[model samples]
Target: MSDWTPAEMPRLDDATVVVTGANSGLGYEGTREFARRGATVVMACRSVERAETAAAELRESTSATLELDVRECDLASLDSVETFADGLAADYDGVDVLCNNAGVMAIPRGETEDGFETQFGVNHLGHFALTGRLFPLLVAADGIDGDARVVTQSSGAHETGEMDFSDLNWERSYGKWKAYGRSKLANLLFAYELQRRLDAADDDLGVRSVACHPGYADTNLQLRTAAESGNPLLKLGMRAANAVLGQDAATGAEPMLYAATADVDGGAYVEPGGLMNMRGHPTVGRSNDASYDRDDARRLWEYSTEATSVEFPL
Candidate 1:
C-alpha cells in the first residue's frame, strides 16, 4: 500500500523485537510504535542512560503496561555486540524481530574499536556480527508465530556506493561520504545474501531478511555530521536543506516498519514512494545494479566473518 502508516501496523502482541540505536531518530520512532502495539521492544543503544530516558518517555506516552528492555550495545565495538547478544540469549528463548537500525552517517574518518573504518564497521560489520550472534534465537522463532524478520536500515546514499574490497578500511585515503555510501551498500548486500542463504539451506528457517531506507529524513545525523566537521557554513546549509527537503523521522520510519511487519518477501527492498523515492509512504523498491553483485556479496560476507570472528549458522 502506497499510503501505509504506523497506525495500520499489525498488532505485534506476543512478539519480542530488538531495535538497535533505539535511543533516537528512526529507531526511537519505530520503538514507540512497536511498544504501543504491545511488542516487547528491546532498546539496544550505545548509551544506557539515554536509552533509559527514552524507555521512560516511551512508557509514559504509549501504554502503562508497555514492555521495554534497555540494553547497552555499542556498534563500534565487537565485544559489546557479543555481550548484548549473550544477554538476549540468556533471557529470551526467541526474538521475533531484529532491527539492524544503528548506523553512523557521513562523520569524519575514524576507526571503530575493531580497527575498521567507522562507517563500514558500525554500519555493516557491527550488524553482521550482531545478526550472526543472534541467529539461533531467530531460528528458534521459526514456528513461534510466523516468519521472524531482520529489518536492516540502509540509505539512499547506497545508490552511489562502491565496494573496494582491497581496502574496506580506507587506510590509504578516506572520503567520509564515500565510506558511508559503501557501508550502506554493504547493508543491502548482507540483507539480500542472508535471504539467499536461508532459502538455499536444507531447512526453511522462516527468518526474512529485508532491507529498507529512510529517505531524506530530518534526523540529528545530518546535524551531528555537520557539527563534527567543524564547518559552520556546511552546518547552516545542511540545516536549511533538512528544513526544506527532509521528512520527519517518524514518517521516514514507515519503510522499516513495513519491511519488518508487512507481507513482503525475503530480500525485498522497501523505501519511500514519493518524488524520486525521497519521502512518502512505504513501497517495495529496487536498489542499484552493483548491489546485486553476488561476487561482492560473497566476498563481503567472507571478509566480514573473518573480521568479526562471527559465523552465520547457515
Candidate 2:
C-alpha cells in the first residue's frame, strides 16, 4: 500500500481526542489537524493559558466545525496527571483517541517531582500512568464508538537507547541525551507490550496501541533545549542544518496522525520516509531489536506498575 498522508484521515465527526502537550510543536499541529477533521480536540497541556491561546489560533485558522477544550496536565507530576485524567473522566464518558505526545528533550540533569530522572519520568512513566488511568474511559469509548486508539510518541533516538534498569534514575551517573533516548525507547516498548496485553485480554474493547516518531522537525523543542544550554554555536549549526534538512511541524505530525487515525493495524511503528527516517512523508519504520524484546518489555511494564502504582487491567 502507498504511504499514508494527512489527507487520508477519515472524517472525524463526533470523535473526541485528547492530546498531551497540545499547546505547542507537533502536538499543537496535530490538534489543529484533528479539529479540522471535525474532531473535538482536548488540549491536555501544562499551561492553561498557552492551551487557550493555541485553541484560539486553531479556531481562527480552521472552519472544521468542532469544539476545543483546553485543560491542565503536568506530566512530570503523577498527582497532576491523576487530576487531569480524573477531570477528563468526569467531563467525558469516553475518549476516542489518546495521543501521548508530550515529552522533554535533552535538559540539564534534574529529577522530576517524583524524584526520578526527569526525562524518563516525564516522557515514559508519565504517559504510562496516564494511559493506565484513562484506560477505562478508552475502553468505554471503544465500546460505544467501535474503535479507539492510543498513540505514543517515540523518536529515532531510541535506536541508540539501552534500558539501563539498574540505573534508570541515573543516580550513579547522568547524561541528558542518553536518558532521553532511553525514555523514547521505553515508549516504543510500552506500546508493543500494551498491544500484546490488549490482544490477550480478548475483550470486546477495540482499543489499539501504536507508536510514532517525528523525524527531524522544526519545533520549539530543539530551540528550547539549545537556549537552556546557552549553546548559540550548536543552535546556529542546528538552524543551518534545519534549513537544509528539517521538516515543518505539520509534516512532522503526519506519522503520529497516521498512527492515531489510519486504517493500519495496531502495534505498527511509524516514522518519516526521507533519508535515515529523518524527514519527508510518513511510513512504517524499523525499530531496533532491543525495542522488540518481549521479556524486557514485560519487565519494564512491571517496573512501571510498581513505580506508578497504576496497573493495566490486561
Best-matching candidate per TM-score: 1
Q: Which runs of model 2 end up more than 4 angstroms from their true locations?
A: 1-3, 143-145
lDDT of 1 at 181: 93
> What tens-digit string does per-residue lDDT give for candidate 1 at 208-275?
89999999999888998999899999999999999999999999988999998888999999999998
> In candidate 2, where is summed lDDT lowest over 10 consecutive residues?
139-148
Q: Each prediction's Cα RMSD?
A: 1.2, 1.6
Q: Candidate 2 on 1-314: residue-level lDDT in tens? A: 33667888888887889999998999999998898888888899989999998888888886555488999999899999999999999999889999999999988888889987889999999999999999998988852136789999999999888998788888999888888899999999999999989888867578989899999998888877777678899788767777777899999999999888876677899889877888888888678999999988999999999999998888
Report lDDT per candidate.
Answer: 0.92, 0.88
Model 2 pairs whose backbones collide: none
